[model samples]
Target: MPAPNPACASNKTEPSMLADSIDALLPQTQCRKCGFNGCLPYAEAIARGEADIDRCPPGGDAGIAKLAELLGIAAKPLNPAYGIERPRLLAIIDEDACIGCTKCLPPCPTDAILGASKHMHTIIADLCTGCELCIAPCPVACIAMVPAPNLTWTETDADRARLRHLAKQQRLTKLEAEKAERLQRQKQLLSKAKSAKNQD
Candidate 1:
């Protein structure tokens, strides 16, 4: 038997636990403004001391403060290079101009966009995080950002976004695991064939 991987050992300062706590404090906008793939990745980076708390503009100064307090570090100002705090916005699609190519669908972390290939896509206003992730993928440039109506981002919104983001992550993890299993099975089959050929 081999020794267990130290990284996987149970410990008081487990990276996953720290990351989870950090992730819970995030704004959950799934915006790359933090220069990360999503809030969870950013949280992991923070847990590993590889990222700073001020990089998340969606969280703003208040959010930074929360993270700093959680990590027992001094709060710093939001890094301008990342982005500035702004009013929450929602994506609006020009239905007529939309080519319905569905390029924007996968980039949406929240699955807020509703459409299929060759069909006009629309944003679910309540779920939109204004991450601007879907805009660049649109070939027709039909998407625009507009201030959310009578809706300000609150902790409740963040909680919802966190759930959606987590669900997306879980789905992706499952897909990757399935792919790896398929590859392993294929390799085993090839190895068995080679062994039989050598014995013949």
Candidate 2:
């Protein structure tokens, strides 16, 4: 797991009090089954009245009841459009089948899949949030989810996963910024070269 962020672990925000409370109740799967980026984004949307509270399939009917109680609204059934709640599943990679394509690495919010191009990949069982986002990207179909009846998402597990997800998001954002900066410099250098050539 990555470093801890109290804001993410506690789901307490200094701003957007309502959203923070809403997020605190969410399972923090970071699964994106809610159709938003993650639990926090979904909570923010709910705070803005832009989304329904029933989209969290990982949270199931019990989760919906908690949200409804929090919002003082009537509890509704889990929205089938998102997914049906079932036993928690953990992703496992078949090493023999994995082509080392490194396709599934980017989609994992928790950074659970570890691998390099032309090398086999593996899942970090404790770190994986079981988001299922990694399954579709595997060209070789080496990734699959198994029911983890013994490993339920306790608060600690969710907190750890949330921290990893937050850290990964931060890293990706920084890398994107660096890429954009490099591109800008390349553009400037090319323009300067054109001006210099024209003067000659």
Candidate 3:
């Protein structure tokens, strides 16, 4: 018989262990501005009652406040040692200035930069999450986040509502594609079964 699923193994008896498990589920961005080794370790520290909730910069005020509620602690100011939260951005590379030393490439979590050493590199704007992780590593400082102009706020409620509507439609399209893939797989399985029966 196959071994039991790892997820099915019990942590039910240990409530603290359950919290640690929850902490482990967080994205591990090792930016310690969280006042810990990384998000997970800070989360684990919070789970274990060893750290305050307001230390995570990436999580920002919302995350800290949520953790405070979860742990029955008062929500406090974000620790100043960790940097302030910045608006989301897409990094643009100045191709003319980019020598492509590749120092910046290692820091980008999304692999958005394209080019080789000693050549011009460009950012794939669509792929960049604008985490600002790449800005520090650039030897030439050619990459910088500029707010995407298309998303800039307009004075009209109609435009804002329209943008939301478009985003919803895109999400629906993605869901439909996933549903179609599932149906296609089911059809293929049925066809294979019918052929096997005929052969038998």
In TM-score terms, which candidate is top? 2
- The candidate, 2 or 3, that scores higher on lDDT is 2
35-114, model 1: which lDDT tens digit per residue?
88999898888777667788898889999999877776678899898989988888999999999999998999888999
Best candidate, lDDT: 1
Off by over 4 Å in 3: 1-32, 35-38, 48-50, 148-200
| Ordering by lDDT | 1, 2, 3
| Root-mean-square deviation per candidate | 6.7, 6.8, 12.2
TM-score winner between candidates 1 and 2: 2
TM-score of each: 0.81, 0.89, 0.54
Clashing pairs in 3: none
Which stretch of 10 consecutive residues in model 3 shows the poorest summed lDDT?
Answer: 1-10
Q: Model 2 — TM-score against the truth? A: 0.89
Q: Residue 48 in model 3: shift from native, Å?
A: 4.2
Candidate 3 per-residue C-alpha lDDT over 40-130 given as tens digits, one digit per residue, 9 for 90 to 100: 5666555545565556564567666665555445677877776775544568988899887988775554456788889889887655555
